[model samples]
Target: MTDLLFQAFIAAGGTAGFCIIFRVPLREIPICAIIGAAGWILYNVVLLTGDDNKVFATFLAAALVGLLSEIAARIFKEPTTLFTVPGVLSLVPGFHIFKAMEAVMDNNMDSSESWVTITFKLAAAIALGLLAIGAIFNAAHAIFNKTKHVTTDMMGTLKNMTTPPGKK
Candidate 1:
């Protein structure tokens, strides 16, 4: 849809602007922009597909961002945060914060409290999503390195056994 594409374009532009402000290298800006756009698109798609749970949608989008950021980091040899921080900027619940403040200004404590609660839930979802992906990646990396080291050590031992005492 045109609206979705427009929103994605806005998301990408916002991400690129943030990256520029934070001094992210120009060469990496496009990648960050694309990641941010993809996350926003996923969030919108989740919302459009029957289940309108904002929190769940946000969590899913955050997870996608984390996964993509991790992959981009590995492929581009950059820090994961470089891709993640800007990518997540668009997903932040800024509107909820604004609404909470507006409610407080109107002496509507209950409304303000609800909005605050919603904001916290959304924030927590984002954190948990990123944390889950980071943990998974770290565990996999550790296992892979361990396997590689063991294999390398076995190869060395085998070489020593066949080298006839290094031909000394």
Candidate 2:
């Protein structure tokens, strides 16, 4: 139990290194770290629950990361990509990818195929989660812009209607 806690901090520490390398702003570093750590922790939590659906776990974790990135972006007036690019790095399965390639070189087709499938599932989850959030962001932005335009147009129409044609 204690070791698991340690690992979570390690994950966050590693994420901090990524933030540094990515040149994330000092003020926003904490937010990036939080998003990364939360994702790492959430992934483990799902596994620990014995659900065994790593793809779903990754999906949930990435979705949280995207949602948090959007929130942070709004708060700091920064781009979501700024935080998400590095934040997602923490979730990548580097060891799995390495082993997958190693299995391929050893001519172990079964192992290689299994590893590749796992990698694909994890990657797809991350991609889809980000996509889902992106769709939400676009929809919200469009709605807000449309509403603003309609409100302004309505005000202008009301003004014109109240003014007599003779006055023009």
Alpha-carbon lDDT, every model: 0.91, 0.84
Clashing pairs in 1: none
lDDT of 1 by residue, 64-150 (tens): 999999999999999999999999989999999899889989999899999989999999989988898999999998787663333
Candidate 2 weakest ten by summed lDDT:
146-155
List of clashing residue pairs for candidate 2: none
* Displacement of the residue 33 alpha carbon in candidate 2, Å: 0.8
Error of 2 at 151 (Å): 19
Using lDDT as the measure, the top candidate is 1
Report backbone clashes per prediction.
0, 0
Worst window of 10 by summed lDDT in candidate 1? 158-167
Give TM per candidate. 0.85, 0.83
lDDT string, candidate 2, 96-145, tens digits: 79989999999999999999889888898999888899899989987875
In model 1, what lDDT does residue 142 have?
A: 75
